[model samples]
Target: MANPQKPPTAASKSSALASGKLGQIIRLLQRAKGATIDDLTEVTGWQAHSVRGAISGQLRKRHGLAVSATPDASRGLVYRLPKAGGTR
Candidate 1:
């Protein structure tokens, strides 16, 4: 008989984030131009509110990341992570 598969552990779940939508969003924000809520929502198939919540609750609070927002004529609000040693 075949062996039963094991459930995902904490390590596995965390590792999955490295390649999941959240990871992709992080990479997008790390770019020079950063990204907007529409961009994140389109990429992740999440609503605008969910994207904001993820940025605030997950990336900012849980991960201790500093995310900033600035006005953009074309994209509404652009979000990005400030450079190391830089103020948010």
Candidate 2:
């Protein structure tokens, strides 16, 4: 017989954002100015690649957030969530 699997609970999902570096990244990106890799690394102390991976793998895939990257004249690359009223 196959083993049964437990479904994901709300606590499990919420726990992912409860604390640590990933949570800090999400909060930083949630701001109006969003955040750059430099900003994320400054806060989380992770490498540039790790920051990108967390945004792509955890925030985008696992949390289902709409993460977009746009170029800035001064900041180079900035990552942010799309505006709520704008078209996806």
Candidate 3:
């Protein structure tokens, strides 16, 4: 019988997340300006709750992303990933 496939390592998981809607969300968050729920919803065509779930459940809990949410005058709440050196 053929050997079973190896489980995905962190590198593989990250790479896998770099293509679909998950990737799109990450890209938006990685920007200097970050992104808003409206923006994420628009890009992914998902409801607000779904976007929140993906950020909270998938990115933070599952993938261990240090995503941050900050209050903004115009944007309300903005979400972003950390910069290279820090989780800012």
Strongest candidate by lDDT: 3
Question: Which portions of model 1 miss their true places by more than 4 Å?
Answer: 1-15, 83-88
TM-score between candidate 2 and the true structure: 0.78
Model 1 steric clash pairs: none
The total of clashing pairs for model 1 equals 0
| Candidate 3, position 69, lDDT | 97
The candidate 1 region of ten consecutive residues with least summed lDDT is: 79-88
Query: For every model shown, what is its TM-score relative to the native structure?
Result: 0.73, 0.78, 0.88
The residue pairs that clash in candidate 2, if any, are none
| Ten residues in sequence with the least summed lDDT for candidate 2 | 79-88
Q: How many residue pairs clash in each candidate?
A: 0, 0, 0
Model 2 agreement with the true structure over 1-88: per-residue lDDT tens digits: 9999999798887776757887788778877898999999999999999999999998899888899899999999999975445555
Candidate 1 lands at a TM-score of 0.73
Quote the lDDT for 15 in model 3. Answer: 86
Question: lDDT values of the candidates?
Answer: 0.87, 0.86, 0.93
lDDT of candidate 3?
Answer: 0.93
Sort order, lDDT high to low:
3, 1, 2
lDDT of 2: 0.86
